[model samples]
Target chain A: MGELEKIREARKKWQEKYEKSCTERDALFQSISGVPVKPLYTPEDAEGLDYLRDLGLPGEYPFTRGVRQNMYRGRLWTMRLFSGLGTAMDSNRRYHFLLDHGTTGLSVAFHMPTIMGVDSDNPRARGEVGRCGVAIDSLEDMEVLFDGIPLEKVSTSMTINAPAAILLALYIGVAEKQGVGPDKITGTIQNDILKEYIAQKSWIFPPEPSMRIITDILAFCSEHVPRWNTISISGYHIREAGSTAAQELAFTLADGLAYVEAGVKAGLDVDAFAPRLSFFFDAHLDFFEEIAKFRAARRIWAREMKERFKAKKTESLLLRFHTQTAGCSLTAQQPENNIVRTAFEALSGVLGGTQSLHTNSMDETLALPSEKAAQIALRTQQIIAFESGAADTIDPLAGSYYVESLTDRLEKQAYEYFERIEKLGGVVKAIERGFFQKEISDAAYRYQKEIEQKKRIIVGVNDYVVENEKVEIPVLVIDPEVERIQVARVKALREKRDNDAVKRRLEELKKAAAGSENLMAPILEASRAYATLGEIVDVLKSVFGEFKEIPVF
Target chain B: MERKVRVLVGKPGLDGHDRGAKVVASALRDAGMEVIYTGLHQTPEMIVEAAVQEDVDVVGLSILSGAHMALFPRVLELLKEKGVDDVLVTGGGIIPESDMEKLGKLGVGKLFGPGAPTGEIADYIREWFKSSSRAKG
Candidate 1:
């Protein structure tokens, strides 16, 4: 008899073996994704699944076990802290601090204005010049952001969408000044605009023009910047926008499929751009579920890329991703508990075989992370990596009954979502009809309702309630003068630069935006001329028009 | 006959972090308030115009980019320009305690912070209606 049949025979004695063993009280009895958890998962659960076909060796087909053979034994996952707040100088200082303290990579969080393609002095950007992240108004701001750092040596990921193309142009212009070639500069642009329409909502142009810009970057990057990841198709914001883990997995992969289809239809070879594609997933508070999510994400991507897209490249089938601990999981009442919460989420990312990870600062729930809090968050990852022995093995939870069951369950649910989205005429058309937004809103509402009704126990929130809580953690305050300084600095840059050259470059960009020319070359020219982000975006807005979201609630 | 509370939830300026705003909008609607959410990138003028045209009883501006200081006052000024005095201009975000006090003195109503219960926000609006409308009558 098979091992499953043997376990089933033993399972028949559950009343004698387990049920009478202990009396249980109220338990949640389910995963956060609403998957029911059984008291025990035996070999009978994994019954008809073939080992080699379903779970191959590391770095092989259907990479469910692990992405690389050696995994962290060969090298640890990149410790990338999402650092940036205040002026370019302040953000630059933080970057230096993180790098000095042994962070392997850098992730930039652009300010609200910069992310939305607005300049520092714009009326809409008055008190928000450098609030959330580094304020990169022009190439000058980007220059100060990377003043002493070597462009080719350290990989950097900039978290900016809607205006990702312009930011990439500025970074390339800076690398050119450093004499670093495009191929040598490696990083990613969170150039996932479909998610913008679906979740984040900082989109500039309508979907059609936005997809055009994405394909243009794919074409340009494949030829020139081979190492640069043109897009990090994100589910981070989707989860933040109120998706369950399964929904986050499904919608993000669906968006990735949309980008692949877009690239192919743009007359580009799937292999050329697909090999450079990457993913970004969020690690919520769910421990085993997150690990299962990362595992299931890999298997689905590998199978679909091979069978569905029929891509011929090995690298094209890998679903390498970056994981950031969930910001939504942090609560302001007992902010310090966030440290413990973040550490577990980070460990899940490691066990899930993330290519890179960013553990959120404890103080993020209140404001931008304080410097000490940022250090603590970094140390959380380091301790897990070095001391805990988590990174010592590959797929340590592979044979676990519960984990494997959850992985299969999540993969099945994701396919159901894909079918639903395809029936609604794929992601773009589904988005146009407010399908993604409504689904996310419903999930978010349900989660909040669960908390309100005390169905879910959030330790600091509803369970161990604290009244009149005094949160004594240091909050990083961005000096109001930073705004005045950034505004004046951008105005000075405008006056100092050659007005004629700036005008000519912007006009050339506008012409390119209107015509069928690839936008990168002209945008790079404008960046070299020190044209501001708002100026460059205004040129495109004139031709492409700004996108106003269709409100969904 | 009783009237439904009408609240206009607006995200002014370039801050696109609307999770709080959207969640609050849904909660208010669930609480039986008519909600008009002006989806992202609305200028102060556009937001006030929508509030006035919709004839909302309350205008809740949600901002997290630390731009509340510049934005809240401008919305108040625009409402004054249109002489919409009866409309309440309450707000919330990651505003510092000091800034929250400053906004209160500038004629904005109570400001909520992160993790402030949605039920509390709904109750505050309901409480405001009883006192203010009763006074007008």
Candidate 2:
């Protein structure tokens, strides 16, 4: 008999003997994404996995093993903390503090005003300025944000979507003042607008204009900011929006493919832009499933880039990503337990061969990470890198029977979603049809039902009873004074800067935005002339028009 | 025939974390309540207008952005100004216990935090509707 037939025969016999004596628990035996999980997985489970075709060696075509050959053995993944909070100076201080304590890279978390492309003084921005992240209104705020730190040295990642071009211009403006050229500046802009429509809901312009802005960035960055990652096509928000793992994988890759098509149609070479493209994903609580998802993501992205886009460069085919421990997985009840949760998630990211990582702080469920909690969060990553021996090898869980089988299953599920999305026109049209939104909502509701039905047990919440559990962890409170300071600063900037120059630059931007021109130059000019983010966004909003979602539940 | 408890689920401010709000909204709908969801980025004025227009009996404002202290009270004040005083004002997010108490004193109903069950939220709205003056009438 063949080896596979022998294993199947043995497995059937074992199951038959064990089934009568051992009954399964009365619970849902499924992955978090609802993929059914059997009690045992053997060699037969990985029967169809062709080693070379499905998963090549590290750093090869169809990179399911790891993107880099040596992975963490050569250089450890960048420990970037997604932080910001209050004024530019305040966030700058936090940056220095983080840098001092082993954080390798900087990920700026802009406040709602900045993210929404509004100024602090805007009435819509009231009560929200500097509440969640640092408020950057102009190049002045950006300069203060990077005051002591040199842009040429440390890599920065800005989490800005809608007004991503404006923020990128501001960063370039700051780099110029620091005597650093655009070529020398290295960073990433979360310039992903498609996901904003699908999940994050921070969109400004409608889909067409938004894609135009993104392609413009792609074209400009390929020529000038070659070292910069123009867009970090993200699945973090989609998963955080309560999408199943399959949905996150499929939707994110679909968005990536859409961007490639947009760039190609706009007369840009796929190789020139695709190499600079990056991704960001969430490392949720599902241990092996998260690992499988990451492996599958690398494989699918590699195949799609090569087969569909005909990306010739190896760098273009390789999928590089940053992973953040899921914030949605944290709990307000027994907040400290979140530390353990984050550590495990971060470990999965490492084992799955992430290029960069951000671990959530324990107190994040209740408030922003307090100083102590942020320190502990940073320490958690350090412990994993050093103490846990998790980073000693690359793609450590690549060949396990259950993991390989789950990876194949996730890959198949993602392909099924891809077909459905294609059937509904594409990602943008599917979004308009509320296809992705409805799927996510249904999955979210199902997960909630499971918890409520006592099928799933969440420690410290549904199952673990803690009577009058007093949260002892310190929560960071954003002082209301931060808003006052930011509002005053933006007002002062408008007063001090050359109004006529700002007006001329903004007019140039408005005109450029109206025509079929690369917007980066005009936007960079506006940023250099001290134009506010809100002013820039307002100009484009007038030309491109705003997007209003139909609000799917 | 009985009147279904009417609830307006509002996402105030710019924070787009609507997983909790949407889950609770559908759960309320499943529980046989009339739910009017005012979608993302609804200002206090927009929320109050929707509440009065929908004639909702309960207004649940979900603000995960730390703007709750500023947003929650403004919503209450707007509802009062609109002469829509009968509706209940309650919501959930990453609100501290101290802030919840302060909002409670200012006429906001019992506020929930993270990890709160959807069933718990539905129960709270149902109990509030049962004891409310609208139910008595």
In model 1, which regions exceed 4 Å deviation?
A: A15-23, B134-137
Interface RMSD over true interface Cα atoms for each candidate:
1.2, 0.8
**DockQ, all models:** 0.73, 0.83
Top model number, TM-score: 2
Q: What is the lDDT of candidate 2?
A: 0.92
TM-score for each model: 0.97, 0.99
**What clash pairs does model 1 have?**
none
What are the per-candidate TM-scores when only chain A is compared? Answer: 0.98, 0.99
lDDT at residue A294 of model 2 (Cα atoms): 93
- lDDT of all the models against the reference? 0.90, 0.92
For DockQ, the strongest prediction is: 2
What value does DockQ give for candidate 1? Answer: 0.73
Error of 1 at A390 (Å): 0.4
In terms of docking quality, how is candidate 2 classified?
high
